[model samples]
Target: MRHFIAVSAIALAAGSAGAQEIAQADSDWYKAGQERIQAELAKTQNTNKARNVILFVADGNGVASNYMNRLYAGQMEGGMGDDYVQPQEAFPYLALVKTYNINAQTPDSAPTAGAMNTGVKQRFNLINLGENAIHGDCAKVSGNELTLFSELMTEAGKSVGAVTTARLTHATPAAVYAKTANRNWEDSVPEGCTAQADIATQMIDAMEAGTLDVALGGGARYFVPKGMGTPNGGTGHRPDDVNLIDRAKGLGIQFVHDKAGLDAAADNAPILGFWSDSHASYEADRPETEPSLADMTAKAIEALSTNENGFYLEIEAGRVDHANHATNAKRAMIDGKAFADAVALADEMTDDADTLIIVTADHEHAVAMNGYCGRGTPIDGLCFDVAKQGIEHSDELVLADDGKPFTVVGYLNGASSVMVKQDDGRFTAPDGRPEITQEQAQDLDYNQQVLIPKDSESHSGVDVALYAKGPWAHLFDGTIEQNVIFHVMNYATNAN
Candidate 1:
């Protein structure tokens, strides 16, 4: 076990203090770290049932992604790119979540979210369905459906809600209440499948029954009729012309569209804020009118924490996953910042003794930090081989055998594919892509070169990390299956 990370061990005597004084200060800090390790090791486990629980997911964030985002966050705070700490990283308990599906090595959001939210590992593309269900068969969904954690919490009289930067009907948020053979059944019911309800319908049904207390996110288009884009930039994607927004309003759900509407939401009733048409814009590209991820989280907590029976809230910064799929690091990093901000705000809002807060991810992406960089390297810049320079004590560029400098950030596969126009109007590449300059490599819009070029990046098969604090957080100390998250929440809140 890592006793403590020497994150604060830096140039302590840069200008005033002498080297000996710095050495003595380092020794004192090391002693303090040892004392802190013993204190943590001796802490008694708190077994009390929590009054509130919050699950914060940075959809596809992984270890490398966390490191890069920490650096970016630090740089944003006027510090070097290294040694930055995210609020999630400050959680007292940590564990690794193995994120494979029932049948595949790499899992998608539907099954991963199902595992974390339902206590059952499911197949890819299946939302809240057990392993007994086939991927695309609707008939098997009845017997194979799994009860989601939020549903169980609601049954136990706890208010339940899901907040995401993605659509309310997106996979992560949808898994909290949706049960379907296919995750894509968010807007359309397959032809002739009259028995199945779409995801948005499920949210309304749950709200009408007083189970869902807050449902805030994007995907306003799917709830309304077609050609309703003018209202909120939506395509009005519903084919049956059923205006679900009107239904929500009729059911007494506070149907909100913009920031003003969200701010004016009735705390006495359920708040259903559909902020955008599709997925909300990335943080760096968002409009001022749309509420931020942190904004929604704070509002949901303010609205839900009033219940006498407590609440179960799911907060997702879903655009991080979208930016990673698009292989846009700058956008992803900014979204990561937004996610961390939400976590920190939540941390401030609730006391660690009575509330159980868990921060985790559904899966990982194929991004990596490459090349040898110097200390304080700009995480968004090109990689430099600092070690290859001579002992002249001056910085020098280290080139590859091909005499090229690579970037600090790259993906295993993404939009970095190279294609040469063929003579017959097709595209093919006989040889691989040529080397690019540092300037070209570090551009914010540049798609980092990858080993395999894909239309969209793939999910990583690696295990993702989970961080936790508060009551029952020690339940996540060691490595655990992804589904264990649901069980831990169940046990912590006594929702069973």
Candidate 2:
């Protein structure tokens, strides 16, 4: 029940001109909230002593997604129940994180994830290379610089690992290991650039250096040959006939492509598992195609925990951001719940006293929950009242032109009555009924369609929540900058 707010000086300065007017409008509420935040921060005490750290990034997750997941879970349990039934509710320590890039009004994943991974603020597209990154030439950037994972592993003699649903070369995952000027230069050369250091190359380097123990999740395409079919039959290729899997094997790293392969690999061998070419599918969508995030987390822990020195692992639920970008609240919530499930699994597998677990998001999406639709609302409930003829529901719900419900989520930019069924096995909005759809929803233009002022279903400048458990959890009370996560993890792992 303790709440805290930490607004930046920039926000405060921006509001100063109109501060008197706003104070007159909501003076009591604002002052009360501020007082409450201060009191909460003052009462917080740091007493945790963690030896290992596991960080989970629910890419674009925000406060709204957290609450919505709780509400959906509560509704599933007959409503008015505790939101704690959702996995995130189990964490005892929480904080608010300020997510903003050094240069952009709206931040991207590169710098946002980099801030958490390195504890330094850099230009928007620069990864772990830090602020010294040149716009076009990433090779010139000094990347051997310390990452939280690298620093921890070196200081504690612990192993390090990174897992994600997206390509291991993607921004979130790469921030933990690879450094580059641009995020999109996965395995490909950057435009007009000579040196190319994709995430796969970095993983191999880490493996060779004996610092990284586990590297899991998609982007087999960057590790294998083009002719070879990916784990999913798609092409998995590297440009120079460089089979990263072979390179990993040359370094005595165990490479696995499927669940069975992972299961059969030697327990003590360092692992490099690439299950897909790109991001892995959602649990509900590709239940059989790939391993769930929970499965991957369990495997990573199993592989790393064997080291006598402990380990640092970063697990990302990257698809949650994709779902949010599409304005699919149900999908986002479901995926978010699954991500939390991975955290719970990690909590159970590792000793809470020795393992530090941190759950947070890079940024927030512009998804907001309006008034509730009333209890006992059928799965196929009508989104709007029939009596209000010609009055459309908010543009948040994705409907079909034929009136068949395709998706329950809608976007803020595009106008589409075409309903597309979600691949996930969830409820779907029924025609003319206020029902939720089984398919994920899309983001819509809140301004043009719903008369809401948001331009696109874009990332918000609002603060995000950080939930932690295990040792050092108490340090997370109150509000802090997104980069503080690196310091917390470093402290927990005894990394300098």
Candidate 3:
């Protein structure tokens, strides 16, 4: 539990003169502080049963990534970005979640998301399976399958849905219903692993069994047989002749391939939409043929709300992870903003009294924000010199030890290394950091400089932030194990 001290009371306790001075100070900052404290003090926790749950996950969105996104979003709105408030940041309850897998320190999306969905820490690269299950061995997975919140919600008569910017069979979203020993078994498994079904097959099985009411995302190829052409100008990836797209249609699921199809989908029918052959385009590069994260969120809510038992939906901005891995800060921040927009739309669509909305990340990335740059510095551009007088930035740019300007945002290790690969296949460091101009650094295609050389940046073993509101939200306070999120959701809905 936490307690708050009134602003005036604290000042008066200091001294009468100090209290009078503080009260007389009518600056906007002072007034804003007082008003915020009052709002906090007046807030009352909702203890009712959570009729609905919407888990909004931004994959690889760690604390540092979130800070960078905030500044970028604020600057995009024509303001100094530090003070900008994202929609989830305004939630009444928050907690720092320790994201570690049972077998690994720095976790990947599979076990981390599995922890949230199944209420237990799991092995690396595994989906909703018990710790005893081997990563790719199917023989040990039979009784070790863990129950996910999606299953529980469906059993309780609630409508269940999942939407992501990544493939529906991707690790994070697959945790919603999949029970597999390996995350990579999306459309096919390795040789000799015949006992365990692929993730896409499991999802379709759930939908066929009436467990999943809505499914939308990018991996159209996984659902169709090889040699089959998709609406996105790409062919399918499945090795077998099983065309899951046709099977979905035969099951009476409303299948949509483009934004137009999604728009015309029947209001009361089950929906399965695939907007891209692979992961959807980064929010900044999205085309008119595809819907935004917010659009998918709105459609999911509308389709599920008709159920009297309410719904459980998981919405993931999975492209943020891809951008971070490639050290593309611009696309990462844009996708993050798109995620915030989806959260805002979901909040507006449901009543807080009956809905439990949780906004969090499955894991943090190695991307970091560096330098003591001045206020209003372009988050995706080079760091600038600080202004000594006011909130505005100085005209000069900050230079690195190499006498060249560096970006405000960069990855700890990624594709943009100073070392170059030679014809002999040896990576050799040439000279110092490359000369980076502000215009070049701010380009949409820019890859931020990295210290270590790797094909892709890695996930960081750090605590990610979780923001929640509505029923039982107060239970999420201070620091907690990532798996506790599942327990909190379970208790909130079942306790009543």
Number of the top-ranking candidate, with TM-score as the measure = 3
Is 1 or 3 the stronger prediction by lDDT? 3
Alpha-carbon runs more than 4 Å astray in model 2: 1-48, 78-84, 143-148, 191-196, 375-411, 414-457
Q: Number of the top candidate by lDDT?
A: 3
What is candidate 1's CA lDDT for residue 175? 82
| Candidate 1: clashing pairs of residues | 229-234
Cα lDDT computed for each candidate against the true fold: 0.83, 0.69, 0.91
Descending-TM-score candidate ranking? 3, 1, 2
What digit string (tens of lDDT, one per residue) describes model 2 on residues 1-496?
1222345554454544446656363676677666655665555443555667898998888786766666555655666323246565557788999888888767788888989888887677777765666655756665434455565575677888888988888888888777777777777666556555666777688778776778888888877776866655688667667777778888888888888887788767789888778877765575554678998899999888888878888899988887666555656666777787898899889887688889898988766543333332322222322222342233333344545443222334322212323468433334433333432222221111121323235777678899887777887879898888988887777632
Task: For candidate 1, write residues 183-202 as lDDT tens digits.
Answer: 88888878877556888888
Would you give me the overall lDDT of model 2?
0.69
TM-scores of the candidates are: 0.90, 0.76, 0.96
Better of 1 and 2 by lDDT: 1
Q: What is the C-alpha RMSD of each candidate to the true structure, in Å?
A: 5.6, 10.4, 2.8
